[model samples]
Target: MSSVCSTFISSSALSIKPKCANPSRSRSKLRINCTVGDVFVFSESVIEQKAVSTAEPLLVSAVRGENVERPPVWLMRQAGRYMKSYQIICEKYPSFRERSENVDLVVEISLQPWKVFKPDGVILFSDILTPLSGMNIPFDIVKGKGPVIFNPIKEAADVDKVREFVPKEYVPYVGEALTILRQEVKNEAAVLGFVGAPFTLASYVVEGGSSKHFSKIKRLAFSKPKVLHALLQKFTDSMAKYIQYQADNGAQAVQIFDSWATELSPVDFDEFSLPYLKQIVDTVKQSHPELPLILYASGSGGLLERLPSTGVDVVSLDWTVDMADGRRRLGPSVAVQGNVDPGVLFGSKDFITNRIMDTVRKAGSGKHILNLGHGIVVGTPEENVAHFFEVAKGIRY
Candidate 1:
């Protein structure tokens, strides 16, 4: 997620039946396309459970479903626009790419939240689309317009131009910054690296930028399925390598952000989003088996059970889903993170404290990571955020 993102699916919209299909399919032959969203009624499927590796960092340990006295606490966009320190840095360096691509600036901004809040996870101050240029998808983050792709991909020819990302070649700064963050934090917290899930990145490239209604991507999905599938496949391979690149460099854990996954109905999500996500998880697991992989899809109340089928280590919940219900759906096999409304920080400290306690109690004990349901909204009080960390860290089982 960027500093700001939008959700397309309304909670009241047609709900996906909890009955799920096999969401995990390898890359060799993924012909998951169906009649848009009318496909999956979800029948029971076997879910493979990976043994949780023991790790030092609290976030890693907690994600592994380890026995921890307190669940790790970190916000989705902890190192972001809301922080005054980041605002000061943004003023100095006006360019989003410059701030994110420059090793020194990225390191400084990523550590800003860590220094002030001492979060359990220190996510890299980078965007999900940071690797686009390396993949031959030229883009820029505009002030009010958000991301703008110079040439939006639509045809078979356009998809061919999008190259497989060589992370060390295109985004060395990211790897270097992650390495430095690991050294600085010294295992006190997990250093997170993230990539946009295929469907989400494809949205930016296909639609030219963020859309209030994702009509273009939907059109491609409905009308020209092959074209969209080709694009998604390219991203699937590129991102798998990107995750491995980040893990090899120094990232303790990596999060996959499918910000636009909710835009598609559950049936459509299986075809367009799930297979590629499972492929990425599968690829990363081959090498970095112990490294924790987390997936976030905003407003994913209906898709909770379907997420674990993708084989991710942890499934991050949005505020729309209750923490307890989310925990129960994901089961003990998958670790759970988030469900606290980011808007809660705007409330009084007592309200904030009460919500945290309620979420914690409902989440029960092990395998829980405390975080905002979504990114911390712009203009959140720094004091309340500090209090969030204070109260969350103070809790004990």
Candidate 2:
């Protein structure tokens, strides 16, 4: 009898071969024939369950501080504009919201990187502000202008209008995509889910989208602290639920992106960002203790020591900090990811290899996830990225 696996059938599905980096490995052991769609039906054979390959993904093991051969590798925006395949998809579906919110498009976009790079983790292709529309805040991801909030929350009344996020109702596509990604990747790699941290979410909603100085949010924080606090509270409760939803729906680990949290001074971060992050971490921990939570704050060199206090299992560092120093500062209590400059990918192959080796060595043996300090920049040489993963995979303790 042949084993079976769930497969989504649709016109948009792309046929691709499974990972067989070593030609010696039999196709039967690794194949997971799947496609991108919503209507699900079983295919001929499931991803094989081989006795030797059943161990948990290296990413999960490393996150738990378990000793492993080397750090598992994946990039922040591994499945976005940088890929030619993704760009083709984007051309067909020009609307960012359409591409990201639809289940079929989400699954296809998320798997594009997996198909080529075979990164150790496959993250869902969605946005941090995805929940905003569900939260009663109308928004759009304009092509060039970026996120555009129809009505920016300015006063106390706006806080009351902001609803708590209900992930299943608001973003069912997210759950569906993650579930499909799990079957597609199997234990070969971990499936990752993510959400925007409260303050960062609040920043977008409050500032009406991306801001240069973030003056409006700071003004609210300084003058009407209570109002800002109210907004943060709603986001905190909603994001906690969002994290739990992602984990329960096949996400092996969830990353909390606090991209704008570092915009606040240490003193302000403690007041606006830190406590809310702690609340989300605490809320999720009670329900899903085994679910690893990773926190990332862009340009976080000033707040490295304080990140672990949120109780996340891993802390991701941007390129501003040295990997060795970041590892020391973050300490051994939490695992570490990133610190490589994404620009390194634009350099010569040898230069990229050396940087990968340097970061891995500085990160030490276990409790590390190799990644770029930030998302892969647009116009990056795809060949160099291939080199990055090639060198990273070849590393041995």
Candidate 3:
């Protein structure tokens, strides 16, 4: 029967194609039949099981931190600014402008990383300013300075100018991108969706872009705590809905990027950042409890102890902190990700391999995800990335 089934259906079904399955949903059963030219034969019993979908298995499994034969590897900014293919694509769409402006292009760009790296997952290819663009805040990604806000939110009135809920139209771009990604990439890689945390988002809005000291945001946090809270509340509400939109579409897991949380001390983080961040995490988790949510804060070495309390499933560390020390500080409740310096990718392959091996070893035997301390630099050597993974796969532990 099994031979008959293989003979009938194997020809048409074995061509590698992308498929998606939501573990939260009911199971899908598959049956086999053999087709010898025109003759058909049935297999044993109908295969009773969950759907045979093609979405990457490793990424989804890693989100749950399930013990796997090997650790899945992918980098921050895995989807952008590195590959020659990506540059060529951008050159083709010269006026494509910022990523959020073109959903189709954005989807294509997002898939580039997965195709080139064959990494375990694909981070969505949209900017951190994406949600703000949805809110109609005048923003643009400048060549060198990063996201430049044309309309900065300063006073209480300016806060009200932006919509409390992200516009519905903007939601589909992300969902559409995920749909396209699901169709494009082979099943071995997972698609990851991310949003900026409220504090980081608020800092951008308050400070009007990247900053040295974040003085304006700090003043707002200290002087007019209610206003800052209100802004954060608005962002938290919108961001929660935005993240949920991604999950419902096809994103296997989500991450909250709190890049500026390092700017705040522990007291300030608890007061101005943690509460709002917790709100977003709690709300999102309520709906999708099994979906892995990672909270990554750049320069957040001081707040390691405070991270688990935010209700995040994973806490990503930056390069400033030692991974072993971070492991000790974080205890064992939440999985830890990252701490490899991205700059090290510019070093010799031997140097890169040693660093990757050391980080993997130092992270010890708890729930850990290997990643760069931050996004890859624009001109990183491809060989170094290859070497990094070679070391990762070669590590015994």
Candidate 4:
């Protein structure tokens, strides 16, 4: 009998390979056939796995603090709504949940930008809230309104109804898609996985969707502190397991997104957000010491000093903070990613090029991954994005 693995069937990423002076820069088409007891390992098959992983991606090398010629470049939301290719797929699939939940669609959508521009990282084409359904929080991504939670969790009893996620069980398509991504990208770029931080996930569930004031969740946090902590603890536990599961399934690195964490005052962040983020980091590190964990909190200018304490390998900086200052505050131990205003992509190609230079110069080389401060905004010109990547990948020293 032939041994089987779960690589997604629709494998596509620029069949035409580009030539590079440093052959190491080109992504090899990996065949994941690492065998153990008639089973195959996804990321373990390549020589890169055997001897310091020969095909170790630039992104991986930079994250690990290795010497490198240039900062690895990829954008948050590099895939999805901004790409014409992705929007075309959305037309056919018609459901955000289905597009993300199905392995084939996930692989195809994730590769859309990769095939076109080949960024230094390929993030899984799934949402931060993707794990919610698995955790028994029913939700949907609306066309215009954004994420909706059918039943908001409040009180101790509602929190009791939540389930810890088992990614292999609930979103096996995710693992399957990731395995397919690793095979397809061939370690040319780091394959990234992401999950919502405890506070962020709790905000969506408690507030029922996107909120400007974040008043509902803040009310819960400020008034009913214990009840909120109980809910947050469940998410901390669930997301840590989710990160480990992603790594096992072939995610080269994972990012934790706390999109709403800045809503808390420093005192509140310490009380509510910091400890849980720390717990997730501690738990995952114990299990996969070599795996890299990245943490991003929007509007984190106030909290940059406190971020590195979570023990994450990388602390992603939003545009609100200057790259040099963010770098100085986070210090030399942890790697830093982003600080470019995503809005910069909308400027002239020359303008975009100049900004990249400024960011790279400030980051001071190595221990850096060049990226947009946040997800590429919708309606950004495709040609400019291509130009951004062209200029980014061409840098030396």
* Candidate topping lDDT: 2
| TM-score for each candidate, following the candidate numbering | 0.86, 0.87, 0.82, 0.86
lDDT for 176 (candidate 2) = 90
Which runs in model 1 stand beyond 4 Å of their true positions? 1-55
Off by over 4 Å in 3: 1-56, 94-97, 394-397
Which candidate number would show the highest TM-score if scored against the true structure? 2
Task: Write the residue-wise lDDT of candidate 4 on 145-252 in tens digits.
Answer: 899999987788999999888888898999999999999887778899999999999999999998899998988888999999999999999999999999998999
Q: What TM-score would you give candidate 3 relative to the actual structure? A: 0.82
**Candidate 2 regions off by >4 Å?**
1-52
Q: Against the true structure, what is every candidate's RMSD?
A: 14.6, 10.6, 12.2, 11.2
Residue 108, model 1: lDDT of 96
Model 1: worst 10 consecutive residues (lDDT sum): 1-10
Q: Score each candidate by Cα lDDT.
A: 0.82, 0.84, 0.73, 0.82
In TM-score terms, candidate 4 sits at: 0.86
Model 2 lDDT tens row, 273-323: 999999999999999999999999999999999999999999999999998
Q: Give the candidates in order of lDDT, highest first.
A: 2, 4, 1, 3
Candidates sorted by TM-score, best first: 2, 4, 1, 3
lDDT of 3 at 299: 80
Q: Write the per-residue lDDT of candidate 1 for residues 1-397, one digit (tens) a residue.
A: 1100001011112232222223445543222211112322111111121223344888888887777867889998888789888999889999999999999999999999888878889999999988899989899998877999999988889998988889999999999999999888877788899999999999999999898899999999999999999999999999999999999989989999999998899999999999999999998999889989999999888888899999999999998898888988888899989879999999876677667767776787788899999999999999889777766765555
Each model's total of backbone clashes: 2, 0, 4, 2
